[model samples]
Target: MPPSESATRLPPGPDTAVTLGIDPETLETLTYLQREYGDMVGMTKPSGRLTYFINDPAEVRRILVRRHVRYQKGPGFERVKMLLGNGLIVSDGDAWRRSRTMIQPAFKVQNVHRLIGVMIGCSDRRAVAWAAAAERGDTVNITEETNEFALELILISIFGDDYENRFMKEGDNPFAFLSKDSTRDLSVVMKVRALRNLVLEIIEERRSRNEESLDFLSMYMRATDKNGEPFSDEELLDEVMTLVVAGFETSANTLNWVWYVISGHPDIEQSLIDEAGRWVPTVDAVTAENLTEMRYTQQVLEETLRLYPPVWLFTRRSIEEDELEQYDVPPGTDIYLSPYILHRSEHIWPNANDFDPDRFALVEGKPRKDRPYFPFSLGPRRCLGEYFSFLEMKVHLGLLLPRFRMQRVEDDDPGLELAINLRSKRDILLKPSVR
Candidate 1:
């Protein structure tokens, strides 16, 4: 049967004259399109290429799942490739499929649960320094704190004993530049080169030892492709760097926002503290089951992601002709979807601009999957770190919230930076006091 008449036409959308190499601008464009042209919008870029903005959840799912092969990682990926090489996040087709399968086992719930000791150890470091700062009545740079926390945790998780014995031997964290600098320019390139050298030296040392190590590096080193071939040195480096970048920034940003939100709403903050205290009574109580039972804490993190998703905007290319409910997407058409816009779309979320964790509670016969929500994205290529991230976040808040009251230092909101990852435009400052 022929497609519906509406599906034969592209919905009206913004002109390319508007984009400014910024994600928030792209999100603004998407919001305006959804308002002006409904859920499905279409337009022609300045280069005269067709594009579509798909907001329907089901269609979004179908495209990412059953039909993913028809497309490749599209526009805006060049910038990511500059940083990640051809890591899983940027690679497509067989390469992506192969890498994802080989690496999926390492992130299984059991494997992630094994990392809890590291989580506790890292949070204790934060607790010690934070307690000292609270005693001095000092305002804490929670932004930097979360960044360092996530960076250190991911390093320890990835390197195990070597994190303390090797990386710390320099007496300074070598991975500090990633959190301090925002620009992905020449300076960032040089810094990444240095990081690569460090990783390469470690990889070689591990190979020379000929002994088994049970960390992520060991797992990736042993992961072989379908041809029974290990990842090339280049591929291994890209994947490791990808993990370092992805594992830290998103979790850190979520925590930074979580602290801001918790500070503003004392009642909700108290609830989180109570829940954490009740469920996670001690370091011993921080098991996988205990972390999973921190339901309210999970809601808080979800709501925070809705407000500030790390990868706020995603761009893809429609490789084959496709028809949406109200738009005809042609082959080679560029497509832009914004989770930041969809999360705040009032038609789907009432009082969408407000912070409310109650919206996440599971109602009888109601499910959040039905909503237009995709903070970690949707479909097959969705983030591999989604479950791991939430787990780490729950552990962090669960361990810390019970003992400290976090107060926002600034009256004004920290606006969005909207780069590769969503970051606060200003440093988020908060004061921590023992409760």
Candidate 2:
């Protein structure tokens, strides 16, 4: 039986029905509501649907981790569904569980560790470009560069040889639009669907060849559920598209922010360069232990994620009635969790807006409850690529920062885009000079 809505005390909120979305206006509304009403603000939307903006870290943790089964992927993901289909990020219930179980093995530590050469290869590709720009005294469009670096890295990682022999023909990658356009509009969705057709063709080609490769596609193709059933062609395509989008954007956005921030803080950049010097002094020296031992670099990335989580907002819908703190969450209620808002909450973090990496210094090996942070989110449903993401970014900075010095062009602030993924509104320009 579900808890009765009438039986519990509702949290404070505005009397008039409010509107919410995955936009700046929606962010403003949530922030204003948090300020006006406090941590848990319950409100009726214009559609008369019940919604709660949950800022209380404990309660947010409970809903996302402990009581997660009572919820389904919610409202905002409709936008994503157009792009990714029913892959892991937007799926719910048994479908999600099955996909997650099958796909989990593909992201295992040993598997990710094998891809170090690919990571370095991608960085090397960027190095060549940055070096050219430096020789010509050009300012690099950092936003575009990170986008290319991450997008190319993910493509090559997924498709292996086909990325060059197939997609990179005609001097243009077929998947370039994905990096160039942030707007996931109808046309973009159509392009993604078309790309899935390309993926479908590749799957068929691989199936016919019965060949193995060291890439995500090969791993995903080999994954099986408990029943030993491989993913269906449709399922394979959805997961492939999911992997493509999910694999790239987080790293791209984070790297963009990382470069932008480091340029503004030379001391931090020098600290990162110094750390890279000791652990990853040369390309050949980068090892599993080296990545793990780069403590200061890790702190810098953690602090950057705190200020600007790639996916700034997360939304979910309650399946069954539930309780969060003193409030009763009735079935069919919408739930909102914003890492952007919570990470910057003044109460929990003193001088929260400041870019200080020391706050995360004490967070190493700490208990789950001790930290109120979730840049990649919490619990079982948390991002599968968390470890892989950190390593990729580390390799990117560790290798490149020591060889080149980059500072913001004209010292301009690249304000945030703040859409589905938090990105710089303006393409951040950086003047690069080889060290």
Candidate 3:
């Protein structure tokens, strides 16, 4: 079949050339395309590659879950590759498969459960800081607080004792740049290279010790392929960097929004407080079982993610010809899917812009699985840290919300910064008072 015939079958989009890059404006561009061309829109990029912005639920699921093998991690990942190297998030084909398999065990529920004490400790550290701020009448920068909290948690989780004894002894955390600096320019690239060397030092020290440890670094070092071969030093560094970047940023961003959202809604805030008081009245009482019982907090986090998924935009390149619903995807086509756009689409979710946690509430007997919700994404490529992040967030809110009440320092919305990760354009500030 000729390309024209296939093109005709694809959904209609503007004939004029469109430039889509991974930036804030890409959201507006995609929204414009969806509004003008409907659910499945096709256009030609400046590179002359055919691109499709797919919103149809079944087609989205098909590409992400069913026919994932036919596609590879596509455009916009070059920037991520600079920082992550061949990590699981940016790598494709056999490389991704092997790394995912080797690292999967470290994220198992039991393994994550072992880190709950660390989660509580991290949250308590924040509590102490916030209490001092409360006494001093200082406004808490929730954005920075969450960033530091998550960074500390993931570092301790990954490096264990070395996080305190080894990594911190270097004076300032070298990995702090990942959160403080968002721009992916050449300077960020240089910093990433420098961080890799720091990680290599830690790996070398661990290798020389030759003792077993419970941290993720030790686990990854021990994890072997099906043939019983371990990851090369370079490969291990890539995976470590990927974990640090992936594990912390998403949870931090979500908690930052959660604090902002809860500050405004008193009824929701009170309900969450009540739940936390009942389930986790004290930090010492926090356990895996009670944390799971804080169901309302989970809904709040879910709704927050629906509004601001950290990885808001995703891209894939079709390696072979494939058929989508009512369209033929030719080979070498670039695919774009936006969880932020789809989660807020009015056609799929009524009153999609509203911050209603009840939309996720169980009805009749089951949760609303039919709704298009993929904050962490879907399929085998779905985030491995999903379980860990949830537990961490729950612990933070459960212990913290009960003890302290926060008021939004600024009444205006912080607005969105749709970069590689979806974040607030301005840092969210809140005034904290002891409850």
Candidate 3 accuracy as TM-score: 0.97
lDDT per residue (tens digit) for residues 1-435 in model 3: 112453357668878768898887889999998998888998888777789999888888999899999999989898889868999999999999999999999999999999999999999999999999999999999999999999999999999998888768978887888778767778888888888887889889888989899999999999999999999999999999889989998999999999999998999999999999889987777989998888899899999999999999999999988999878898899999999999999999999999999988878866778888888888989999999999999999998998898988787889998888888989998999998
Ten-residue segment with the worst summed lDDT in candidate 2? 1-10
- Per-residue lDDT over 80-153 for candidate 2, one digit per residue giving the tens place of the 0 to 100 score: 88888899999999999999999999899998998888899999989999999999999999899999999988
For residues 157-246, what per-residue lDDT tens digits would candidate 1 score against the true structure?
898888888879889778888877767876787788788889999999999998787789999999987789998889999999999998
Candidate 2 Cα errors over 4 Å, as ranges: 1-5, 362-369
Residues forming the 10-long window of minimal summed lDDT in candidate 1: 1-10
Root-mean-square deviation (CA) per prediction: 3.0, 2.3, 1.7
| C-alpha-based local distance difference test score of model 3 | 0.90
Query: lDDT (0-100) at residue 358 of candidate 2?
Result: 76
The CA lDDT at 260 in model 2 is: 90
The lDDT of each candidate is 0.83, 0.90, 0.90
Report, for all candidates in order, the number of backbone clashes.
0, 0, 0
